[model samples]
Target: MKNLKESLKRRFSESNGGNEVRSPLRVLLRKEVAEHIRSWRFIILLTLIVLTFIASMYSSLSNIKSAFVATDNSSTSFFYLKLLTLTDDSIPAFHIFLSFLAPILGISLGFDAVNSENNNGSLIRLMAQPLYRDNLILAKFLAPLLIVAILFFSLTFLIVGYAMCISGIPIEWQEVVRILAFNGMTVLYVGFWLSIAVLLSIRFRQPATSALTAIGIWLFFTVFFQVVINIAIKAFIPDPNYLSADKIAYYNEVILNILRISPSQLYVDASTTLLMPMVRSLGPVSMEQMAGAIPSSISLRNSLMLVWPQLSGLIAFTLLLFAVSYALFMRREIRS
Candidate 1:
């Protein structure tokens, strides 16, 4: 009897003493990222990105081949030359493709983030652990961001490899780095939507409602609001040329600032600035000898600076939305 009691006491003491305290942040991040990778949604998302990239490359390369083999025809050669040149600027082309697809992926990953956890009864159990409440929100936000980055870089590598093997064109270091940086910006731009979707997920307990809300917001930015803005601009500013150079510049700045309200638009404009050189008008000081003023294209540094306001806006909005979600999750009563 004494031995049994002593053994039981020793076991209890050892269990208490060996309660290894792992860093909640590290534990949550790893668990969340691993769970995301294991989910069918992540697999499907990655597969879609890979398959789409492959399809695009096949189609683009076929077009390039046809362009090179075209007969000595005026329209054929003209169009083919433009097409071939555009292919050389693949980074911009990739941006155009990602502009549409990235938001959908972002929304998909985040729309059900919180509600699904609640439905699965995981949220309550997760909270029961010695983890900070904020950890869950941070994990949810970061896992998708990491996935976005990984898929982007993977697609870039695949594209570069295919281009090299098929076209026999050497990859320039600058082109590779530029494309990589452009892809990174796109991931962050997509992260903004993910953050918004996560905020909605936390706000609504029903998964369907959260998903619908996210779609509605997506449509508003992509279609509805843009139409409204166009109409408003046309109606209010009937005479576009009445504005002077300084006024036009100021107006452009204002318009960009307003559009930054929607991350999608902000991203598109920032991308345009990044990918294309500015084609400035000659204006009154028009040099008769010169075709166009084309006031020196903005440097990459200037482009990055121009995007700063939008980037900062996105970061601020993401932080604010996340803060709200975290606060709500922490304060809510999770009844098991």
Candidate 2:
């Protein structure tokens, strides 16, 4: 391994000649991306996402005609956006399916990111090269992130094209913007999970341990967390029947604030607001607040404004995890 590293370093130095040396970061990033693309786990996850996309699109198309007819008399617009949010009862909409599957895709890509290299005894050898630890860790996160963005954008365009063919409606600029924004938010949401997985990978020595821990975290947020929240809410409220309106409102607010602590809830709120223009509020709206409001779809600006807090939260949490992972990975001793 030492000889191989020396030879590779020499080759790179010779190739660079007197010019600036090539960036090891770029080489590592490309290698990470290629490995992710060629991995069987990635292939399986990609196939699952594609299948779900197809199922959701099929369900959306089946209901889209009726949706159009039903909304014909209404002043609502952005029908093109419905291709993503609309679906039958049997299959969830694209965004809903994505929320569930995207996290798994992220976890699969990153749960073994660092630990697997360490287990295979390549990490110390890589560190022996010209690469900085910062570059290596950053490349690990960025490569999966880039691949995720590409996958999501491609799927979004595919949905758009399929919708256009079936609905015979050119997508409005507003609709295009909204769809793009949703895709971007989804990427961030997945990145949050990816960061968590990466952190676990760095923290645990075994890839299997990190992978299981990451999945356990996902399951906690996706399933058990909500249940615990509901139980806690019930324990607090006890009986809403006897509670005053003000008390009920207070508890409702508390519940929402608690739910927002979960990343999944944040993603859902942001995605829903972006994909559905009619969603004007993420929280409870008093009758007084809605009394004089016009019944109209909000503009793209308003939709973005509505989701900005959630989007910001997702960004903050993702960064926090990655930063923790980076700090830990950088400070740790690497031994062969």
Candidate 3:
């Protein structure tokens, strides 16, 4: 700890003496990123994610051969995307695995962001330096977010590269665009959880409490929330067995809307739409609306339009949590 403080002080002194000046936020951000990278928890989390990626990729590769054999040339349109969205029963698709694991990663990175420093008495000492409270908060948030972006993007490109090597097929421009969009959505999804973890870190003094709270919220949304929704629908909504077609469609829409309240659902919806171009709608579509619609895959523009609401919801939720965390941290009293 003494060595780290000395290094940071030296860097600041050197920067001040040189022609180049470093912003306090940048210096703090670098410190945060370096600390996270070096932490044992981060190492464990990264190993877990990499192992899952290997399993998912193996499943995807094994299925890809059969998938190619079964599909005609026209149906093989998004072959590269299949590498990401395809999987056997034993393991979920890469994107699906990401949907489940990424939140945990984000939460692990951020659940102790503020409280741990405060508990260790570093928060007060750090604040005593020539740093604004906002810069510290922003560095705490942005550092993890930046690390997440790099990790996700690196894994995504690795998948792309591996798929190309095995399949010997050049990826389409549209597929590239779609994959990039999926990566961006994933980063945002993880950022949403990161924000929640940060919020809890600020709210709770004990890091353990905040960590468990974040995990509990994750479990509810990932597993039990859907169960709760199903029970509510069964209790309130009329049984679909005797409902008219229009009523059934409306009922399904209601269920979907309620489910979309969970960030996991939103991410699944947006990612499915982006990766699978055949998906035309997120909600139930009546026969009348589908009567003239062709079964062909939609264009990238149209797919984005289809999932724009889900994407917007993710962005809005993430920003809202960060804003609340910012407000709380600014008003917080840090005593030496």
Candidate 4:
């Protein structure tokens, strides 16, 4: 702790004295990036996710080969993306595996962000510097986010490149665009988890408590949420078979809406839509609505339009969590 403070103090002093200058936020961000890169949590998370990507890609290649042999057609569309979406009996799709594990990256980076420093009393010392008060939290939050984004985006390129090599299929430009959007949405989904973890850090004084709280919430949504949803639905009707056709449709709609309340569900809905342009709709469709509908996969624009509300909900929730975090942090007294 002593050495860290001395180093930071010396760095800040030297920067101010030198002819070259940098913004405080940039300096803080760089420092944080270095710390995160060296942290054991970051290393473990990186290794875990990399191994997942490899396993997923291997499975996808095998599936694509089998699918190709089974079909007479040699021209397969969106072949590169199947690297992320296609799964064999052994391994699941790349995005499906990612959807389950990606939040851990955010959780690993942010679970200790504020409270750990406060517990060590270093946060107070860091704030004693000439930098604006908000800069600390702002830089802390953004640095991890930027680094996580780069990490995941790089992994995306690796999967796509490998899938290209194995499949020997040419990817369309539009498909490339859609995959890029998929990568971006994946990052955003992880960012939402990171934001709330930071908020929890503000609310809880113990790093362990904040971490456990975040993981608890995550588990509830990922593991038990749908179970609870199904239970609620069953409890309501007792016997879904007794419902009329119109009632069944309404019941399905209610279930879908409730499931979207979970971040995991929203990510799945949005990521699948983005990666698999063949997906036409995420919600209930009336007979009239589907009467004139084309059987083919929809365009990227159409897919985006269909999932815009889900995307918006994810973004809004992230911003709302960050806003609450900032408010709570700003209200906290350093003496406490």
Candidate 5:
């Protein structure tokens, strides 16, 4: 084993015209990132997101104008955050735009990541190089993730800048931290879908098949899953309106917990908690728990504490899907 390892290091070093050996993951990552940046799918998604940003900014500006004129002065000091979350007559808020579009971007970047390369005979050739199997699969998973991060972060900063310019309000430090954290959480959410899509890519040799599979799952969760869950809940727990408040609350809790199993629901819960500081709780809040609770926005730390389980769930799902993809890829034969 040691002899083979030394031979590979020597061979790879000599082949790359360097005395020291280096991991091929970086080389693969750079190549994949460049490809992703140049892909039409990425371009289309970015363009759509930018258009949403512009529309959102326009409507947000109008909304913020009205908000500032209101006499209540009830908005927390972090009013600037509202510029991105609030919607007006015509356009959705920035976060709303993201909740819908982020999955499509993830599927686009990952649905064909592996199979397209296989179709073009690139995978075998790339694998033919002096690289370990782990390096190939890990980089394939990460490069798209990094690309998604770039797209998300760029859009986030652009929205923030536009909000600042239009609102004319300097965002507070705590607000900036929350926004930055929200960006990271959004990245993780999208990256989870990316990993799932890539797993489909690895499982299906046909790029179109993998792409369709990913889109089908997205549609199921986005549109039909809630309806299905409602039907199931209704069938199991009939006449909830006739029940007492405690019973009704328990039924709703059961339904909500079941719904949270879907990735989209989890993403929405976490995003809402992070972006909307006024959201006191995601789960059932009994009257006792709500007693004496002022109707006010909480600090960033408290908000994170509320949503940490959600963030962790997203992370776990992403890692689990990636692990499956890695295992499948490692077991696959290039020659076959």
Candidate 6:
């Protein structure tokens, strides 16, 4: 008890005028972020990211070079070009790479964010400090988001560098800014998923269970949900062969709205629109393509705005999950 009192007094003295100077939340956030960076997991994640990017660049370099060679002419100089013209195929490759890999990176970095601390008993020690119980959860959440931002930027730089080197062209300011904007959106999208992982970590005391839960949820949303949603839509809409054109249009709009509920699908739809010039679908597209595919339903800005609802939904879901964990932690009794 004496030690506890002295510790409290010292903590108070270090605080600002009886109020905590550095919130426990901030400390926890910083500590978690630093720990993540220093850990082998983070290093492995970075290594994988670099490796994947290198592989992608290598695989696509031949095609990109061929395209450049085909287009190379005395009249059209690679220099003095204001923008790197993105072919439809180029855009799809980015989407494919991000979709398959970004979530893995996010989940790996964050699925253990809180559960590990709890398992190691550091969480109890952390709460003993002059910090609110919920601060640790909040910090865990913030740490993954920061890491997401950093990884996204690093990827953006690498992609741009590769593009410049392969094209043997100077990247324009506008192109750089556009790439940054796309990457910024991607970071937020990926961070939203990481928040879900954080929420799972907080909910499960066992790190392995928490990670498995996160992965399960990801698979359901990305893979199973997609199938279920498509089937439901198809069953209800049923080709609309007997419907009027206006009715068909209305049905299509409704289906689209419903589909956008899944962020991954929203990401696919939006990215396709945003980078239509650079994107290409790998699987067999419907007859709609051969017949001159309908242009994207929304422009890039509009598509972005449209995705805000889904984004908000994801963020709110994460926050709600974290809040529940925070409340539980606050009520928990730490045994000496």
TM-score of each: 0.76, 0.93, 0.93, 0.90, 0.90, 0.74
Candidate 4 lDDT (Cα, 0 to 1): 0.81
Tens-place lDDT digits, model 1, residues 225-308: 867886777776647578676666555556655666787877776666555434222122223535654435555566677767
Top of the candidates by lDDT: 3
Least accurate stretch of 10 residues (summed lDDT) in model 4? Answer: 67-76
lDDT by residue for model 6 over 287-308, one digit each (tens)? 5554875442223355445445
Models sorted by TM-score, best on top: 3, 2, 5, 4, 1, 6
- Which stretches of model 5 miss by more than 4 angstroms? 1-22, 69-72
lDDT of 5 by residue, 1-336 (tens): 234345555556666555333446666676677777787876887788788667876777688776565414675766756766777757667777888888887888889878988898877767766777888777777887787787778877887787678667677888888888888988888888889898999999898899899999999999999999988887888686689888888888888988999989988898888878889988788898989999888988999998888899999999999999999998998872
How big is the positional error of residue 46 in model 2, measured in Å on the Cα after superposition?
2.0
lDDT of 4 at 15: 74
Task: Report RMSD (Å) for each prediction in the order shown.
Answer: 7.9, 2.6, 2.4, 3.2, 4.4, 6.0
Instruction: Give Cα-based local distance difference scores for all models.
Output: 0.68, 0.85, 0.88, 0.81, 0.80, 0.63
Quickly count the clashes in candidate 2.
0
The CA lDDT at 191 in model 1 is 84
For residues 1-336, what per-residue lDDT tens digits would candidate 2 score against the true structure? 555466547656766654323466667777788788888977887888689767877887798886687557668657777667877789888888889988988898999999999999899878888767898899899999999999888988887788778778767898888888988998998899999999999999998898999899989988999899998777767698998777787788889989999999999999999988888999887777889898778888888888989999999999999999999998999998
Could you tell me how far off, in angstroms, the CA of residue 58 lies in candidate 2 after the best superposition? Answer: 1.0
Better by lDDT, candidate 5 or 4: 4
Weakest 10 consecutive residues of candidate 3 by summed lDDT:
16-25
lDDT (tens digit, per residue) of candidate 4 on 218-334 = 999999999998988788764766777778788889899999999999999998898877778888877978797766667778999988988999999999998888888888898
